[model samples]
Target: MPPGTPFTVVYELDDECALELANKTVHGVCHLGWVPAADGDYELRMAVLVKPNGFLGRLYMAGIKPFRYGLVYPAMTRQWESRWRNRNRSGGARPR
Candidate 1:
């Protein structure tokens, strides 16, 4: 997604499914526990965080444990989605 665009956390708990995509940006951290296929190993369940720029995304996905992924992910997403529809309105009727 674009800078300052947040996302609301939609936690997935499915078995043997991989590659849950990020909203707009091309890549995202893989929740390792989310099994890629049947009989797959337990990897990791990511909290899906986003950086202001792509650079941070790379640093994060590259296993930068120093940063706190648990805290930042869901918060920003909520903010982004709250503002997203308003920001991209195509002349729709305003809510009463």
Candidate 2:
């Protein structure tokens, strides 16, 4: 998201949807997808498919994988949950 190409909607269907973007820096293609659980809660997942041009790209990804998984992703999930709660309190549209 940092000065990267805008995210484009990749797929939309009853069960799931995804948005993907290409970065200009160390990262390559990335996508975040959402699907509904059997219990009626939504589950989110992110995938980073690397097209590492050289050693640097690969190293960068490896170095950041821990931080990404441990910090960034969990924070993102919490933020999403908070937003959903706020929306529900304000009578926002039902989360699909």
Candidate 3:
């Protein structure tokens, strides 16, 4: 996505809610480790929980090659790192 592009989604805080993220562009589900930062924020459903080296990462590498040719692993790493830094700065909490 382009810079400053806003993403909108509905976050459900129910305990039954799966610890997973479904990327519409990649068309795959990623098993996100149980991180309950937000009780009800749509961005939770879109966070990059699984790295590109993981199972879904390989699939995205193979499938996304045809469209603009981009990989998810690098993106996932960048995303996770940035989020981690932000979280640390906000409240100085370590990743679990």
User: Which candidate leads in lDDT?
Assistant: 2
Give the Å error, residue 68, model 3: 9.5
Model 2, range 1-96, lDDT digits (tens) per residue?
A: 224436566774433345565554443444454567799887665666656546777777788889988997688656644554465577765556
Clashes of each: 11, 0, 0
lDDT for each of the candidates? 0.40, 0.59, 0.42
- Off-target runs (Cα >4 Å) in candidate 3 are 1-27, 32-70
Candidate 1 per-residue C-alpha lDDT over 35-75 given as tens digits, one digit per residue, 9 for 90 to 100: 23355533223344344337655655556444444545455
lDDT, candidate 3, at 61: 62
> Which residue pairs show backbone clashes in model 2?
none
Error of 3 at 59 (Å): 12
Q: Where is model 2 more than 4 Å wrong at Cα?
A: 1-17, 26-53
Q: Rank the candidates by lDDT, best first.
A: 2, 3, 1
Better of 2 and 3 by TM-score: 2
Q: How do the residues 22-49 of candidate 3 rate in per-residue lDDT, one tens digit apiece?
A: 4533333333233445654223223333
Ranking by TM-score: 2, 3, 1
